[model samples]
Target: MAFVRVAALSQLPEGGALGVEAAGRRIAVARVDGEVYAFADNCSHRDFPLSHGEVDAAARTITCEWHGAAFCLLTGEPTCAPAFRPIAIYPAKVEDGAVWVEIADEPAPAEKAGGLRSLGI
Candidate 1:
């Protein structure tokens, strides 16, 4: 697994989320308070793109528009229902004016230990 460039940092709007594909995985990249975060684009409760939702920069949350589910940008943990499951979060960074996301070849170490849903993430 390696860091893959998804989008130019300039292309990502402040206080918003952008959908990108990395290693064939749908990802949502968000910029909040000058920091970037990446997570699965799909909502856990429904098959909706998180990028199509609203971002609360101050609260550090992204809300799914389809069902009003909100998830933390940092931890990908659901802050509101109808979502009880947390989304998968990936490592991300901005360098050389580009947004880079680290995609794992296999399940992440944490995922291997207890699986994503089993660990509540």
Candidate 2:
């Protein structure tokens, strides 16, 4: 896995979350008390975008608006009910006013399914 630029630090307001695409997957980036955290964008409960939720910088939690599920921004663990599974978390860092997140590369579906490219020519 390698760190990839996602957004400008200025664009992420204090106690805010943003959904962005990285490594062909949706990632949720949240700003809490000046630090940035990145995790899977979808909620474990109902597949809702966590970016639409409210963030509590002090508690380091994001409350999903869809079903009132709160999750720790730092650990991606559910802090409240309706969601028991933890979302996948990624290492996030800021460099020169830009936010970068480390995401693991996953094989494409076709490749996983033995597409033509997989043929031993």
Candidate 3:
């Protein structure tokens, strides 16, 4: 895994999320009560960008603005209908006041190993 710098910690406010692209992948980085979580930017329901969604700090969930789908921020699990599949999640770390994301050199299979096959990649 290679750690790619995404943004400065100060740039992201608590209870907010930032969308970043690294290695051709979109990542949603959120800060909740001083902790950071990272997930694939697209919502599993409609392929909408999760960064455009709302972040619920207390519930630790991200609600898609497009289709009302809600997903757990910490685990990226879909908690509502219309989105039975969970989004992909990545490991993140903060060091020296900067956010770094661990991106695999080779893209890993999607959250469900064979699930993306239908996409005809």
Collision count for each candidate, in order? 0, 0, 0
List of clashing residue pairs for candidate 3: none
Q: What TM-score does each of the candidates earn?
A: 0.87, 0.85, 0.87
Candidate 3 weakest ten by summed lDDT: 112-121
Off by over 4 Å in 3: 108-121
lDDT of 3 by residue, 20-47 (tens): 9988888889988888888888887767
Better of 1 and 2 by lDDT: 1
lDDT score, candidate 1: 0.83
Best model number under lDDT:
1
Q: Residue 3, candidate 2: how far off, in angstroms?
A: 0.3
**Candidate 1 lDDT, 1-121, residue by residue in tens:** 8999999999899998899987877888999887999988888776588999999988999999888989988787889878777788889999999999998998554334332332233
The ten-residue window of minimal lDDT in model 2 covers 112-121
Using TM-score as the measure, what is the rank order of every candidate, best first?
A: 1, 3, 2
- Error of model 2, residue 102, in angstroms: 0.3
